[model samples]
Target: MNARLVGSGSDTVVLAHGYGTDQSVWDKILPDLARHHRVLAFDWIFSGAVKDQDMFDPVKYSSLDAFADDLIALMEEVKPGPSVYINSEGYEGGFDISEVEQLLSSIESDFHSWASSFAPLGVDPNDPPSVTKFQNCLKRMRPETALSVAKLIFLGDQRDMLDKVTVPCTFVQTTNDFVVPNSVPGFMAKKIKGKSTVEVIEADGHFPQLTAHLQLLEVLRDVPGFDL
Candidate 1:
């Protein structure tokens, strides 16, 4: 649950990463963002960065609600005010239980193969170093943890929570995300209670922040409140 607070400013922004990767996913954009605002970045224990086993309780992490609660707690402790939540696709609203379950099953069966498949979908497949680095990152994730977290995502329905959200929110959708289909963003945009924007970026993959960092950063900067 430890987090790194970077930069120095009166305002605060929290960067949340999604499944299969850790806080480093935001590395491409952190420097620029940190120059103007304080950025809080942290790794979920299962993210493989936090090695302390005692920090994670298997039973507590069995659901995404637990993760949501932790996010609120982190915000309350650090920023304690209206904060922007820049989440990856699946972590936000608009998820189909069946589709996610199948994807999870595939990942559990072959983590490396499934992880590497992103290249063909739009990632830099030809780059040996980046490919190896991504593969190694996936390999660090235990299959059990992946399956458990996936189940937590697929089985959980967060639509009600969206109705409860009162802050200005933005959902960034990738053009060619294999895990989350094109329909998710629209579905989420309609369900959210507060003011929200669903931005469809030209990036072509689930992990656009890693594969298409510049384009993603451009889209993020243009987001209403995150222009900082």
Candidate 2:
């Protein structure tokens, strides 16, 4: 459980990276965000940047709840309490089981090709260096580890926990998001326990923090607690 804190401010912002990527994806928005509030970003145990592979327990991480527990622990240790919680990829949960199974199967067979398919609508699909870098990091994991986490992420359901979440949530959904559909955020806003808003940016791609930083920054600026 290692994390890095950026910026110096009264408020703290937690940048939580989703599956298949590391916290370095947030580099684009970190500077602007750091100017306003403290930013805390961490690499998940399965991440390539994680030096301590011992922290990752396959059985414990077999479910999404384990990842959520890690985030909660990071927040409690770093900031000691709650703050504006921003999550990438709507975990409100929506994915066809067959589609997920097929994708996972494909990723297991050809990881690079599978990774290259997620390039945004307007981005060059000729396997950009960004995609290469992303693939390189993910390539560090064993095929079984990647597939296991992917199964948990794409096939697992977490809508039941939506009602249990009492924190303020801002679902930053990107248009043409290949991983999580555009509708998940709206579904999340309707089901979450506390105040939750869906901010759909006119950006495409799964990793908006990397591909659509400026637009993401604008959307974050208008988020309820991030208006700094």
- Top-lDDT structure, candidate number: 2
Residues 26-103 of candidate 1: C-alpha lDDT, one tens digit per residue:
888888888877888888777766677456676899877688799878887876355556676475433466766667
Please state the error at residue 132 of candidate 2 in Å.
3.1
TM-score, each model?
A: 0.83, 0.87
Give the clashing residue pairs of candidate 1, or none.
Answer: none
Query: Where does candidate 1 stray beyond 4 Å?
Result: 79-82, 91-131
Our tally of clashes for model 1 stands at 0
- In the range 1-228, model 2's lDDT, one tens digit per residue, is 458888878788887776667788788888998897888888888876777666677799997778878887777677634466666555434456676678888878987667556432223234376566566666665556677787777777777787887877778777776666778877877888889888877765667777777888888888765655
Candidate 2 Cα errors over 4 Å, as ranges: 80-82, 91-95, 116-129
> How far in Å is the alpha carbon of 221 misplaced in model 2?
1.0
Model-by-model lDDT, in order?
0.71, 0.72
